[model samples]
Target: MRLAVLKERRPAETRVAATPETVKKYKALGLAVAVEAGAGLKAGVTDAAFAEAGAEVAPDAKAALDGADIVLKVRAPLAAGEGEVDELAMLPRGALLLGQLGTEHAGAFAERGVDAGSMELLPRITRAQSMDILSSQANLAGYRAVVEAAAAFDRGFPMLMTAAGTVPAANVFVMGAGVAGLQAIATARRLGGRVSATDVRPAAKEEIKSLGAAFIGHEDEESRAAQTAGGYAKPMSAAFLAKQAEVVADAIKKFDIVVCTALVQGRKAPTLVSQPMVESMKPGSVIVDLAADAGGNCAMTKPGEMVTTPNGVRVLGYTNWPGRIPAASSALYARNLLTFLTTFWDKEAGAPKLPPEDEIVRGVMLTRGGQVVHPSLQQQAKAA
Candidate 1:
């Protein structure tokens, strides 16, 4: 089987789907790997490195994708523009495309007869843990958010007593307790910041406590059952949101740094920090919105941009913070895709054989046989 890795074309997207290490692994798996020239430049991997690892460095995307049976990418394809060609049109019909192509774009892939696997939809089961792209990417994003916030803030993360004076540690409040939020709490704590977190799911309280961060949310019978079987937070009632917002407004005023990582799957992020809450924060305070791509959990956030409010509170809404650390992000993401592909590799067929019965395969597969096959996408198609 032949596999092609295309350079990311999205603005500010520095990550690549395959790295030199992964290219070597794919070669060992009996697959010929073709990579677009400069595919890994932003991620610090050179074409020379890929060639040394036994990968063909094609001159362009078309050359890389031509005759390839499988295509690897960091993001979904982009539509044609003045100076750009339609990336989806480059793929051969019936090709297996794998990456974080979200379900909302399933119709485009289905129309092209592309078997697309969205890594974000990977099951949370233990067997598929190695293939969980969301977790791997979010872990880096959480760490980067704190690091960037610290850099943007004037004060130190750790409390310090010097000959001049005593400097207090910054207070960091995380808005969610998912993979990203947990990592944020841990990272902030390690940086010596006084960290605290809130989440609607009752189980997150223990996770917050375990990370040595204070848990600050109303938890009752209703909230306890507000987590889905897959461990994702479910939308809360209006009454619950009102109460939670009140609590957040109070907590946020005392925090020097706020990292908003809350997101509802396939929905706009619930706004947890309102304008009044932001105005209440002290001048020079910073808020990092990791959910900026999903409409943000902070009302003050401007997606893909950083803006300071008149009150002097800085709101950062960089949509792809994980891509800011491209080398590490690409390495982890490539490993995830590699693990997922090898898990379903059919030795006799010499290609990936995704059985419809496999839960992991079924969970991520978005298009098959010229149709949007995923249950959620199917429902969305029907609704449309």
Candidate 2:
């Protein structure tokens, strides 16, 4: 089987799907690895490094993908426009493409007879944890959010005592207690900041407290059922959101930094910080919204840009937080894809044999047999 790694075309996407370390592993698995000339350049991997790992370096995406059995990418294939060739058109029919291909692009891949496997749809089961791209990437996003917030704020993170005077530690509030939010709380605490967090899920309360952050959320029936079995947040009612907003509005006033990571699966991110809430915050305070790409958890957020409000609060809304630390992000993400491949590799077939009965395989496989066959996409098609 020939595995090809293509260059990322998204404007802010600096991370690549494969690294030299993973390319070597692919070769050992009896797969021919071909990478675009500058595929890993932004992620700190040079063409020489990939060549040293015994992989072929193609001149461009078209050459790299020609006759390839499997294609790995950081994002979904780009459509023709904005100085980019239509990557989907170049893919060979019946080839498997794997990455963060969202539901919106399912129809295009199906029409081309390309079997698409979305890393975002990897099941949350224990056996599939190593291949969980969302958790791996979101963990870095959470840590980076705190780092960015600290830099944006004028005050220091840790307290100081000297002959001159005593400086109090900064206060940080993390809105959401998922994988990303928990890492933010931990990072804030590591920086000597007093951290607090809030989440609608009941399980998140213990997770927050365990990380030495105070949990702040009103307990109710709706809050108890806010988490799905797959460990993702479910959408909350308007009434619950209003009550939760009141609690956040009161607590946010005392914090020097706010990290918003709340997200509801398949829906726009719930607004946790209102414009009035931003106005209420003290001058020099900073807010980092990790959910900015999904419409943001703060009304003041300007996706992909940082802005300061009229009231003097800075809102950091860069969408690709992991890409800011590209080297580490690429390394971890490459390992995730490599692990997924190894787990599904078939010794007899010399290729990935995706078992239909396997929950993880079934969850991630978006299109097969020239149709949109993933359970979720099938349901979405029916609904449409």
| Model 1 error, position 365 (Å) | 1.0
- 1-384 in candidate 1: lDDT tens per residue? 799999998889999999888898899889999999999999999999999999999999899989989999989987557238688888989999999988778988999889999999988899999989999999999999999999999899999999999999999999999999999999999999999999999789999999999999877777988899988989899999988888888778999999999998878999999999999999999999999999999998999999999999999999998998999999999999999999999888889999988999889999998988998877766898
Q: What is the Å distance of residue 6 in model 2 from its true position?
A: 0.4
Q: Single out the weakest 10-residue window by summed lDDT for candidate 1.
A: 77-86
lDDT of 1 at 219: 70
Off by over 4 Å in 1: none
Q: What is the lDDT of residue 363 in candidate 1?
A: 96
Q: Per-residue lDDT of 103-214 in model 2, one digit per residue for the tens?
A: 7888889999999999999988999999899999999999999999999989889998879998899999999999999999999999999999999998999999999999
